[model samples]
Target: MLVLAFASSVENAVQRQLGIAVSVEMLISAKTKVTSCMEYVLVWDMPIVQFGGGIYRRRHTRIFGDQGHASPTICAYSLTRNKE
Candidate 1:
């Protein structure tokens, strides 16, 4: 529910900025498959120190990585047109 609200807010912001509304269908069809993996790197250098693990399994480790932090989560709704 929270993710849906966030997506709706983001969609509204995008529409307002673009001066046009985007169809929800378009948003649903645009989702990409994601595979998350963990890695450790220097904060400043950003070079890989370790790799090949899931964040959940390595939660105790000081170093971790996240990729989909800003990715949008979307929900689909059926399209309907009202005829008067």
Candidate 2:
């Protein structure tokens, strides 16, 4: 839920700042993961954008509840939607 919330915030920000439009087919995204403290973090250095242009990009770690490990993957986000 935290990750979803963060993603929603990011989407809202983008739509507000850049509007619901892509620039020359640019897909903005963020790396999301839940920490041991249940804190959500967005790795800005993680440069990955899905082909369909989802704001919620792939995850770098496999997290369940508060436990997670370094298992980078190009997975899909269930809590994602293509803006515009």
Candidate 3:
């Protein structure tokens, strides 16, 4: 599944940004860089980065399991706010 999140300081700037909860310690453990935009993160591993095509740096989008047999479409859940 795909998950979209930002650092502990940003908010939902767009419509349809589904919010979820994540602990600060958990986020730190997972190792994430700054993310000002979710658009940039989702396309990090596509054939575009070689051309210097993103605003924020992130780890490559992970495609888990045997990619050859994995589903073409990913199920995505999103968002977690530091406060209400």
Candidate 4:
């Protein structure tokens, strides 16, 4: 899974242009300074509760197990808000 986020904040045109210029410069710097991106792998070695990644639909009850034991029961009340 890959998550990408690009955020740029600038007030005026000059600032925005400068921000773009700086971002391009940084990308070049990163490409030169860092090793291969393909060589690096993102590994999450934590448990389900600790590892924050999931998609919970609305009006659903979800249960989780911990090491073959029942951990907790999580009921999804809404997609936006979670009710415990």
Over 4 Å off, model 2: 1-48, 53-56, 64-84
Q: Number of the top candidate by lDDT?
A: 2
* Candidate 1 C-alpha lDDT tens digits along 1-84: 221111133233223321222332223334667655433221221112233542122231233322211212111111121121
| Residue pairs whose backbone atoms clash in candidate 4 | none
3 or 4, which is superior by lDDT?
3
Give the alpha carbon lDDT tens digit for every residue of 4-76 in model 3: 4332221222212344443322233346675542321121122112225433322323533211122223322
Ranking by lDDT: 2, 3, 1, 4
After superposing all C-alphas onto the true structure, candidate 2 shows an RMSD in angstroms of 17.9
lDDT of 4 by residue, 1-84 (tens): 322222121122112211211111223354566653322223221122212454222222133322212212221212224323
Cα lDDT of candidate 3 equals 0.28
Lowest-sum lDDT 10-residue window in model 3? 39-48
Misplaced by over 4 Å in model 4 are 1-38, 50-84
**Cα RMSD to native, each candidate?**
21.0, 17.9, 17.0, 19.1
Model 2, residue pairs in steric clash? none
